[model samples]
Target: MRFALSAFAALSLSSAAFANTLESSAGALNITPMVTGLDAPWAVDFVPDGGFLVTERDGDLIYIADGTATRVAGVPDVAARGQGGLLDVTVAQDFAQTREIFLTYAKPQSRGAGTALTVARFSEDGTALENSREIFEAAPGFSGGRHFGSRVVEAQDGTLFVTIGDRGNRPSAQDRSNHNGAVVRINRDGSVPDDNPFVGQSNVQPEIWSYGHRNPQGAGLDLEGRLWTSEHGAQGGDEVNLVQRGANFGWPVISYGEHYGGGRIGEGTEKAGMEQPAYYWDPSMAPSGLMVYSGALWPEWRGDIFVGSLKFDYISRLDGGGVTEVEQIEGDATSRVRDIVEASDGSIWFVSVGDGAIYRITPG
Candidate 1:
């Protein structure tokens, strides 16, 4: 049985301990805790049969069910330094039969580390992953694990899209030769898709679908199957972009934010041929995970966009194509919210890294 989440239990008594009851347009929202005592959890995804899977940035994969959290084996060695370590995890499209899952993280490299994407099959008893193989590894691995931008999303056509960061190298984002600061498209078994933007190009990496990015941490597919991302800016230029195939998203060249110490970034925010962000925050939200609301639980929230604000300690809700911020839901405790997803039963779930717990928001 799923969580018997009701508004009465959460709203009747005044306790902000685990669940919080708040008033909304449609009705009361009951925010309940699913699990606790996690160590810097980065991403969470549900399994086909039962339970949910979570990844810890310190290089651990956990399975939580019936109030028990078990460590799943076969996680690769991650750098676990700076902001690099175990990251996003997603169950395969055909997980029931194939029992496969996809993962992304900062792969330990000689230079320092780079983001790597892989697919693996889970054991029959769900104890360990088998046949793990690296499907794609970002090029020109750099030192200092500042921005790995490791997030993987599967497309409706069975292809995968992986996000790579600038690796603290601003100019590398403009170079098509390296995989840094770009989105890559690949097949399930580490093969390149023929229809990729630069597949037939010379000198450019064939896997690159889009280039000129800073550090995109959150990747989500909208209801229309289009890819959307939330990226962190240097100081004050945090952005949300509608990722397009072969599109050139302006990074250091055209940004709404300035440099760290206070100078104009990249020609003062507007360029001749660079794509503008769908929406941006001047002071920065430090956005991480993104989700396009399906309106399953609350019908009024049909097409809204929800994002985890790392620096702001709250959830920002945006509306439609304009990407305007419509609402901000704050948690009881100060939390560096990491990942967000809509549960199958129509509940909104997210992982708070600073709080070290998982919470679900459902209509009360």
Candidate 2:
């Protein structure tokens, strides 16, 4: 069931080790880039059969089988401009029996106005989405198109972990009344969980699990069942944090990153009440997608975290416990990495935002 990259095509790039790289040698890693020429690929999810579903920012869902991509029809309309557009997608963990899939997109309102982060479920029948239903929608659509952190992961108890961006408003991140810039835990049916952090709080949405996030794009669960997320900071200080229930992560209030013009972001990098990041980067890689590798293909990388970077244009490898061993791997280096998914067979698949290509990386 495992997919193997041809050994004849091994390409090794110069090691651009960051502060997080392991001090000891961990053996060689060979990465081979497979498939090119896509149009802004945002996310990739494996189907029950051997194929995969790849979403494009320009409103296209491509079905790739045997390495050839075919466009699927009946995709809903998307804003498809600036930072808004068709975004992440995930197949239900019980997809083999249910054929259910979830998708996130920027729902367009006016000609130029839109609110990012809408989740919908659909049934797949070869080349189209059938029985599509919008499960959740962000409130108070914003005008500008930036900071739409829309990724979803199912928890062990069947609750859905949904990441929502700040909607270009920094103050809203601290506002408990709004859903922006917070991780919301809800039932799979889009209903707020009764046991949510702010369930009985006045003016606060019961779905808010955690708050004060600038822009969280990637989320995943470790083998220990701990939830982890990667958020983009202003100019520097991109972060990886272990998500805790009801924890407030300081965004504008505190950040290791300064403004693009070198202005102070908030009070400081650490505040008394706010939770600090588990790890942060200085240059801001603009991490988009995250996945933990426990696959057999890369035994040396087992239990490691693989993060796809948009600003750095590479893959960052981190040790399981936290951020340890950061190395920029080459594959679709010309494009921004959108999402990383470890296949059932242990091969890693990545989506490119710039060119929309889906690249499969395996041991060469």
Q: Across residues 1-364, which tens digit of lDDT does each residue of candidate 1 receive?
A: 1222223244324435656787666678888777766778999999978889999999988876654456788888888999999999998889999989999999888888999987899777777889899888888558897889978999999999998889989998999989989999999988998899888788999999998889999989988988989999988889888999999898878899888899888887878778899889879989999999898888778877888999989888888656888888885632888999988898999989887877888877
Estimate the TM-score of every prediction. Answer: 0.94, 0.87
Colliding pairs, model 1:
none
Instruction: Flag regions of model 2 displaced more than 4 Å.
Output: 1-34, 110-124, 331-334
| Residue range 29-94, candidate 2, lDDT tens digits | 444344445667788888887777778788987776664456776677887878888888888887
Backbone clash count for every predicted candidate, in the order shown: 0, 5
Give the alpha-carbon lDDT of every model. Answer: 0.85, 0.75
Model 2 TM-score is 0.87
Please give the RMSD to the true structure for each candidate, in Å.
4.1, 5.9
